[model samples]
Target: MNDTYKMMIVDDEFEIREGLNSFYWERFQFQVVGLAANGKQALDLMQRSDVDIVLTDIKMPIMDGIELSRAISVHYPHVKIVILSGYKEFSYARDALQAGVSEYLLKPVDLKHLGESMMKLKHLLDTERQSSQKLQSYENQLANSLPAARDHFFQSLLEDLLPEYHEAKEKMSLLEIEMNATYYCCAAVKIQWRDQPDGSLTDANKLAKATTIIERHLEASQCHSYTLKRKAGELAIFLNLNATTVSPRKSLSLLFDHIIVAIEGELGGRSIIGLGEVYQSLLSFPDSYKQARSIMERHIFRERSGLFQWDPADSLHMERKEYPYSVETKLLDAVLEGNSGNSTMYFQHFWDSCGLDSEHAELPLVLRYLTPLFTMLERRLDLHGASFETMANLHMPFTEYVEQFQTLSQLKIALDRLISDITLHIRKLNDVVQTTSHSAVQQVKKYIEEHSSEKITLNQMADLVYLNPSYFSIQFKKETGINFIDYLKYCRMEKAKELLRRIDLKVYEIGELVGYQDRKYFATTFKSYTKLTPLEYRQSFITY
Candidate 1:
């Protein structure tokens, strides 16, 4: 809050030092904080006081003004210096300037010139202070936003959205993420609380305690690791392991064993962890994450809480099957007709058609079959001008909703209740005409326009408006007369064309700026859209 600068005067003559110090320095917005008989004393004063400006003579007993200026430049660079010399030699001025003096004033110092130089230094100091404050503020904001940014980046990485390895690495560097190893693996942890009586620890408290334990153990492991708290009581950890690590699997197992014991023993909870296979490259991280998540979801069927490591030989091998679209259609038709009996029958038939048996069905595999049905039902509800939430009360994603049930019977009961609710809503809205809102479509279009230079996907847009991806695709085409993918392409190409007019940017640089990381692919797509290559288009602009 103090706008007055602190000034220190250093000289061998007691009269000169007192004479200058006695002057009304306060009128110049400065306070005479120190009067040093020599440069050495001035440097000592600087170490104790916050001296802003120093006025010193070139010749002193212990240390000269030039020596003092050099010392301040090294130790306190922010402090400004003004050299006052009786010798008007160019060499004296040159030495003072080379030592980082702000200004040099001759002896019999002119009061007006001194005042002017002091004010000028004050203005310069104010500017530097303001710049430093702004830089500090920016740094604070960056620190506050870093966690969310890191989460988003890691989410994208786990989803395999950042396909370019080099780009991903660059982002990691910018975000200050370090993974200093040649191999990586992923693990998922889920904590299930035991029944607690009144006044017991809350679930959030339990989770926090468990997270502290996990993080402490992770830090002790001395391997590069990051923990993502995906949701309540759930964590995903990515570990970077050195190639020289002796049996990474054994090391991880021991580490997680300690974590599991600490959480259960201290928090009165059970923990389940699933470890994925290690890979040599970060590009395979998504594969590892998927494997970890799949194995973790199988904990619902397990009899005990422990670490489950992915074994390539013992992994469940299920042949991939096409979605039963015909059965789903029948179920959707039954719901639309408000035929409760047929809807129930068709829902059961749909389940049967997915080739899932209650005894041997894995949770992930079961959800995979159920996801398409849920999407179909959501689309049907959207078309009928009905809110999906009103029908099913599913406030979360279908996959998460399905994970709550521990048994096949419980899951079946939940699905049946959902179907009943859907049929009931259908009967209630029998007289309502089928309609779709253009608001969600318009929002997606606006987002595409604004973020054409970023990676955009139909699923991301659909998630933005809480719609099924398939339904969103159909609605987008119905509203815009172009499919979602083509619309995205159109937006990117339009941006690319606009960037082509800028002569300063190279072709590859422009391509990267417009969300195309691969120059060849950008060129091919640009030619396909505009009937000319990017360089050719730019040359045409120059020619015109």
Candidate 2:
């Protein structure tokens, strides 16, 4: 609460003004900062002073309390008004109340009543100030989180997660992304260090610096651009071009030329940019991104650092060949069924189906064919609550997996090993499901109860119970008549309710104890679960 509130005294009579000013306003945690004879003078004084409350007489010369109150209500709605008047007319009090007067006291004001009114106004001011502070804190937090949120939105957009135009438009507006262009283009930029290692601070600093340089150049260009860090040493730049532009392709090419030159000449590092064609609708952004990524992947064969634009004619050879989807499906089924031998056989069959020989498939045609296959396998693992990290000890960005092998035979061997590892992991999971099917669900429930305050994931729980995520989900639901996600939410909400009983714990601190890192999200979830916000719930428990 604020220690002192500044107040103004407005009255035509000098005696009334002086007497009120002489009183011990400090006792009520207020200070009389100004004295005005009328409403006009009061308004003038208010402009010069920071007044929190205004005590004015109803009938005064030039301007009156009602007019002053209305003016304050219009210009300074936060300022509390107390009316002191000799007139006892019901109309005077009615007009005063309508004009936003906080309290109306007659001619001979009671000292006790005045003191009480001051206390009440002070409490209201304090509460409003606290609410304002909380709102400002939330705004600051939202501001800090906007960058990460924007990155996530762009990633989802590139992945074609927001399928509907309206949904994508809503998200873009929420993220403050202003992509108001008739044409859209995507470019994938990969930064390779000439000397430094991948994960060093120098790598990050250089990448950030390179991004800054690129942004500066883009800002100077005619088109609108947005840059997102796709992965380590990789950036995705989305361009919004005007329909009136003569040659969007040539414009983007020239921009990339400057960007590449700046990185290579200034940072002594190599940069490869893959430019995609412009599209009319934002829904086609994923197609543009795919094209750009496809061009970027070709860098593995060329081993060059420069700008590469997508050419429709260049892909004709690969487009004519039939993709071995049947072999891929067989391999995926074998892995999921935990048959390592069949998985290996199917994987080899898939490789041979690609029409590859013992010599390295260094051609871009073979890469274009194999890349989508590996991407599909990765996606399949993800769907089954598995990852390349756990199964094959491989980190993401899939390109790293391909770069590990120099020849087609080596890639085949590595992929076979991955298939073997995945099948073995799945076999173990199936064995556990057979042995402790019922107790595994109980074990997961107990784990959730004990570890609700920690980060828990369905995949982690599935791994713990040694069952496939899909199977674990079905079994857990059958045992408890509730899904794993709901059960986890129930445990967390129950814990939050219990913590809200403690007067010492702040709402955010309670949220943290209940495993919600974001305070706003916690409050929202809490209100949705319990029909009360964290603060409201706590207040309900208090004994007045």
TM-scores of the candidates are 0.56, 0.53
Count clashing pairs, candidate 2.
Answer: 0
Question: Could you say which candidate leads in TM-score?
Answer: 1
In model 2, state the lDDT of residue 231.
88
Model 1 TM-score (2 dp) = 0.56
Q: lDDT for every model?
A: 0.77, 0.78
Model 2 misplaced stretches (Cα beyond 4 Å):
13-15, 45-49, 160-162, 192-201, 217-224, 257-269, 297-306, 317-544
Q: Report the C-alpha lDDT of model 1 over 244-277, residue by residue, as the tens digit.
A: 5478888888989988888878887788898988
Deviation in Å, model 1, residue 538 alpha carbon:
51
lDDT score at residue 112, model 1, on the 0-100 scale: 91
Candidate 1 runs further than 4 Å off: 1-4, 195-202, 301-304, 316-544
Poorest 10 consecutive residues of model 2 by lDDT?
A: 162-171
lDDT, residue 85, model 1: 85
Residue lDDT tens for model 2, 1-544: 6468899999999998999999898977899999999999998877777899999998888888899999888767778999988899999999999999999998798898888888888889888888878855765676578789988888887876643343355455445466667778899999987775554558889899999988889878756678999789999998887765458888888888988898888887788889876776676677788889899888844555789998866775434334555566667666765778888888778777677754845657567667776666666567667777887787776666777777767777776777788789977765665556689998998998897766677668889988766557656766888766667778999999887876545788777667665676577678768999999999888652
